[model samples]
Target: MVEGKGEAYLLIDVGHVLTHAAYIARVEGTARLAAVAEVTTTTAAEGGLLDGVRRATANLELLVGRQILDRAGEVRQPRDGDGHGVDGVVVTASLAPLLRVALVGLTCDFSLASAVRAATLPYVSLERTVSLEGPGDAWDAEDLEALVQEPPEVLVIVGGADGGPVAPIREMGETLSTAYSLLAASQRPAVVFAGNERACRPLEATFAGVVEVSAVANVRPSPEKENLGGLQGELAHLFYKRLGRSEGLRQLGTWAGSALRHDLDALARTLRFVACRHGLARGVLGVDAGGNGCRVLWVRPRGPALNWAAPFGLGSGLGALRQRRDPTAVVRWMCHPISWAEAWDRLSNIEVRPGGVPETEEDWDLQQAALREALGATWQGAVRAWAGYAEGQAVGEADMIVARGTSFTHARTPGQAALMLLDALQPTGLVRLALDWANLLPGLSGLAERDAQAAVQVYDNDALLELGTLVAPRGVLRPGSRALRVRLTVAGEERAELDVPAGSIRRLPLGVNERGRLELYPARGLDVGLGRRGRGGVVEVRGGALGIIIDARGRPLGLPKDEEARRAALEAWQREIEQA
Candidate 1:
């Protein structure tokens, strides 16, 4: 175990399909990533999660030219005098089943909404919701019996203002107690009470000895005030408790001690830190499209970060994505012609073999299409949730967007990833795009808690792959008309100039890390996030893999109704990005 602060740290991400490990050490006064390795995740039936972690660690040791594991195959902690071990170990994971949760609340609009928002973690599955808002406030006999039959892992009881009515909450507590009494001890669900403070003691007494009861701050303290942080914290704590039940996780947790974190939680923390660390005026937006879930996190400088999760992604969640959206929706983004049955067959094949790589062009296109739809669905939910708390600025007004998970990281090319991001998020204004190519955000988050300087240095230097800056205007324009004029100057010399037409995308040649100046002049009706229409200015820009992308597709990016035209447009856009 690490005695105190350690210069060399080992970080691991135990994902559902893949496990990744990275070694970071202080080199010449700066934290530098020394090595990274990944291996297929091992299921519990295949000797538990540690098998995959050990394999990845072994690979990392080979790359770093040091032994991270001892003869016992356990991670050697508190670096040895001969440089045989790491000083600290940190782990983040998304390898467990979703936490089954039931929401019991007073009203649909206030407490219930807040509870839903709080439960928006990738590993949380809200199984049931019982709202006590109607005139017939008493619990139905059928409802109580259902709770007894298939009890959720957690019952989040939230309602009533801080000083408001307590009798209703107490009544609900009694109903829950009666249901808990009917179930076996092992079947009873833990209760989290986030209701009126006045009802806390009564609820505790109601469920005493019957089940675990944790009382947090009221979710809706007043009609105008909603505080969800305390409740979110409680839910996360419960999730960790449940995760500890796994033998592999428990062992890893022992080694990590206080440094272990849930993957989604860590990602959220990292985004918030990045936003605040950079003092971003617009904020940071992040999306993680994993094998089994998709998450969108929006973190501004000074407000509560908004998080949204959907239990659908590129791999195991592909089938769920088909059920969630129309089958045609996934087919719409395809650049090549495909029949409905063929598309359905491909999606089914992926559901059965989620970890399998795409072997054909059609399969690749289909996966990208599904990814776009999945991210779009998650982004819409985030927007709706943010609408209530958004202060003046629009939800899409982010200065930097970081894409994570295999959907972006494993794309065939950086250009493909950038196009998918632009199509999925459809952000407006001038924004910087990046990819968590190494899946290092979670580890960096844990590292930051222990070594802030090291985490910052590593994050700035190695964590993300800059995809360059994007300029997407927001307004309607005539097709083929000049939408914006751009002049690019690199190192005080004019490099390129072009006129961007409406309904088209253009890529400028600017190599990575190359500093440049861009001058934008918008059309009469277009607004590039400036104060007014046709208002534009020059901004200092940094280059990335895709360089400068001018997306003149307009806001709420629309596609042609005809399938042929749509395919043509998608193909054209792909070529535009690829050929750059």
Candidate 2:
């Protein structure tokens, strides 16, 4: 695809918990992934971040049974006759520090809300959200000192719709200029103006030489629409520019031929590419959880959208985990009752050893509980982002769901991963569940833009493991009520008829790579993405290690208030899937 023969491409993905290197070679003019290796990512190592990269690369070389780097410690390009080198290298990272951002806008409810949404991407963190409507003292010496003391890397100024609120916009601009003047030149933050258009020139003049300034179209152009594309793009560019200043990242970028990209962007690109390629108009949903953060990407027919939350995971984010709303939220997912203190203590260990894996049944239960809570929070954040951008736009419309992270990838079985997602997201429709367990999507992300066909072929063929197709209908019913009737045909085998009861989870065996035809009929008042209750439809689905899971757990999936009852329900669900 890159106009070469026997070309070898190396892809490296750096994350807070792990660094992975994958070697892909164009063998006989066909690109194929050769080997993959991973190493713990420790920033304190002598070589800093590059330490893990080098280790992972070395391990990958061992797997490929060749030398990819020279003695001088550089990736050797142009493979020799014996296949000792790669043609090019690309790097992607999720381990970059969050860009601290100060958002200045007209009001907290309107423009500020939009600014918050723009600033909450995986790589950008909102340090301050300042409203221009407040008193003049809001920008006083004390306030300015607080902002300038430890300057944020970027300042995002967004206010009223185009052709609206000129004076407020000017005042905010003047305030920003004053704040910019207080910061040391070396520490001054870049400023982005996405406010009223008429005020751009004056604002540009006000801070022209004092600080770096870029102006884009108003985020709220006319009250009816918000144009965040230009601002989002600018923010991404600035984030990368700041990230490149790091010592290790700079060197990695150089070796990558400036092909370094953000992990969230890569995830978004991969999902969008897959959905569009497959013509899946209902869109695809992807969620990635890691030691430092969590990311959710939704790809629709129009394009890809994202939501990010940081310091809120099962591992190194324990500090932020303490700030969550309720401690008991996760307990309901566990099979046995555990005190909040005990649960917190178990999770605290993950902060110390982010890559630790469960070895015992108790450990597994605790780990799954934490994962369930983290995913629920991540989903809620994504929903909020969608609400901020467009009313009534929810993630439920997604017909396919893909997940990544240690919890999903390292689960004992595909059924474990599927149940975790089902319990956390609780969608009321038929959906396909898959896991990026192989960590191939990030590599594909780097390759998609270069050799799209190769990247896609690899993704569909190897990247994802189809967990199973899930059918979850909405609406609650009596415990003994018949929720659905399913007729399934798989692998030349046909199931006469199966009835799934309300508040239960049922699994049917279907081998991997097997095709299946399903006819689903929901009882009265139940709906599985169909128009109404008593509706039915026939769909084609592919099988995986775990077959089709029919969950009549009801929408907003309920849990018994009685602790034992809740534990029993959870145990039953886990048993139902795990037995498969």
> By TM-score, who's the top model here?
1
Give the clash count for each candidate. 0, 0
Range of the 10 consecutive residues with the lowest summed lDDT in candidate 1: 252-261
- Candidate 2 on 237-294: residue-level lDDT in tens? 8888877788777877786464677777777777777788767777788888787766
What lDDT is obtained when candidate 2 is compared to the true structure?
0.77
Q: Which stretches of candidate 2 lie over 4 Å from their true place?
A: 1-6, 27-29, 100-152, 158-168, 179-188, 195-198, 208-210, 217-230, 256-258, 323-329, 390-392, 490-493
Candidate 1, residue 419: Cα displacement in angstroms equals: 0.6
Candidate 2 structure, TM-score to reference: 0.87
- lDDT, model 1: 0.84
Displacement of the residue 578 alpha carbon in candidate 1, Å: 3.2
Can you tell me which runs of candidate 1 are displaced by over 4 Å? 1-3, 98-152, 158-166, 183-187, 217-233, 255-259, 490-492
**TM-scores, one per candidate:** 0.89, 0.87
